[model samples]
Target: MTSSPAVTAPAERVRPLELFFDLVFVFTITQVAGVLTAAPTVDGLGRTVALLAIIWWMYGGYAWLTNALDLARPGPRLLLLTGMAAYFVMSLAVPRFFDEGPFGLILGLAYLAVVLVHTAGFIGTSGHRGISRLGPLNIVSALIVVAAGIVPPQARTWVLLGAVALEALSPVIAGIGGFAIGAGHFVERHGLALIILLGESIIAVGTVASELGDVLRVVVGSVLALVVSAGVWWVYFEREERDSERLLDAMPPQRRGRAALLSFGYAYLAMITGVTMAAVGMKKAVTYFTTPLHDFELWLLPLGLALYLAGLAAFHRALAPVWEWTRLVAAVAVLLCVPAGLLAGGWLMLLVAGLVLAGVVVVSRTPGLNET
Candidate 1:
């Protein structure tokens, strides 16, 4: 009889089941955004980011996990099923992600279950650097998330932030000695995850449109949000995703994991967070189209775009430094416009943010930005 081939499947394609598991995070991102949608305050926004970091860390594990696991086998396939179940249950608690309520406890427990599953599954696995050296650190970071739920809300934010930092930095701090990448699978997985998050923006449009009735103003606002999302898509997939994929495929095996760590693990975290934030802003803008802007509510779209751009730029810096400065400037410009957005009202501010991002996309096509 054959031994279990749960780990070290290098040539296998990403299976349909893996794609099916990804469905859960679509709702996961939405739930995080819904939390901010409800509050749209400084505190609410901070909590949303904290919650997103935790959620992203959990989702990210599978991306790296599957890159090493031989999911064609029963053991790994069942592991994924269990992880997805936990992911869905935890997503249900995302709205209360940082609230010091029973839901927080539930979210923590679910998240811990996910971490435990991955950590335990990877135990005794051979020749997987991400799982081998960095896996234990993932467990530690997840424990921080579990601890965060029990703390007061204020401290919960900091604890979650720590959890994100620890997990994101694990590659650098812990080093992925045995970590290797099946580049094709790794790239496809992360890219699909980005698409899923971008789809959240589209989902936001529909979700907002339905709530807003069929008014012309709402229609226009909805279109603008889609435009913003499309422009974001172009900025990323136009060159960045392709380049990163090429780079990962070209890298030597021993080094591939760290590069994946920097480019996909940490960088994609920023991108996913930014995309989710953009969805939150877009949803709120749907409401703001008819209503007037108040205080920080106006900041959502710009802030969202800024984070999204910043994430892109950070990845560019890590992989290809030349594009970094330009991306940074574009991100900062959006951020600088927040005060104007605060006063400009929702629809108008969204229009401004959308236009500015469109311009950034144009600039991204310049000769130098093609360095990949």
Candidate 2:
């Protein structure tokens, strides 16, 4: 009697390495927050955006790699875990890199080392099928980052930005590869990451509110932050994710793969950019009265709100065929509230946040929007 080979499932069981990978991101988040806290300027904000963009690409790439490769094997799992450890070390060095001049090169080298290790493992375990698909873009991006490290200090920023651009472009190239991309898990991980970022925003709000000590300010700010966070949650998860799941499940595998790549890998850049900046905005809102709103702080609030709104709109557009009028209106309302919030002080900012939340709740409850 001849026996058939055991078929491994495409969606592998979540492993300890995946969990450890997530822990490294916690440090990544902290490093980013620390950088924002120290610099807190317009240049600082730009730097933070560039840095987060690069880190998000790194995280997203590895995530897709894990989704594609079977990590149940000891060799693959150990290599990935080691890469994650290297990533954690790189994350730890971010604050120092930004603060101390001499340490920047050390930090850059450390970060490159992590990327090299991960890239090598990704290529090795991905097999011919997967490697042939994403290999070229991966190789291109890895080289750019490595080359960026060799540039002089004055020229490093532009080089780093170029490296980041290369990394961001990898998904577009990878999507051209016709493979069974797991849409469900991809969306799930990003959704969870969004929640984690929002949670950080809430923590920032609470901490800042506690420092205020005034009952009225604390109460007002706390409520505003909660409402804003709730509005964000309502906007994304209300029906968008469900719709995406249905759409992908119904479509052909190749098109579904492209859609999943576009939605989770590309679209999420806007969402995370907004969410991280919103954390900065919340910090500014809490401290606006004591510290005069600098040009950067002034810009952060509106920019963050705009990015968040844009991301929501993009997600809705992708999920539903018909335009979401309510979402468009909500986005406009949020943008309009920023200047008014500036004029009325921190409490007013909180009030504006509440209004935005109310809009999301109303739209979420509107007829014909319910998931099947």
Best by lDDT: 1
By summed lDDT, which 10 consecutive residues of candidate 2 come out lowest? Answer: 5-14
Per-candidate count of clashing residue pairs (backbone under 3 Å) = 3, 0
TM-score of each: 0.89, 0.85
Candidate 2: which stretches are off by over 4 Å? 1-8, 12-17, 99-102, 121-128, 146-154, 171-175, 212-214, 289-294, 368-372
Return the top candidate by TM-score.
1
What would the per-residue lDDT of candidate 1 be over residues 87-156, giving only the tens digit for each residue? Answer: 9999998877666578877888889889888776665455444465767888888788888878887688
Alpha carbon lDDT of residue 292, candidate 2? 40
lDDT of 2: 0.66
Model 1 gets an lDDT of 0.74
Question: lDDT tens digits, residues 294-318, model 2?
Answer: 4566666556766876776666556
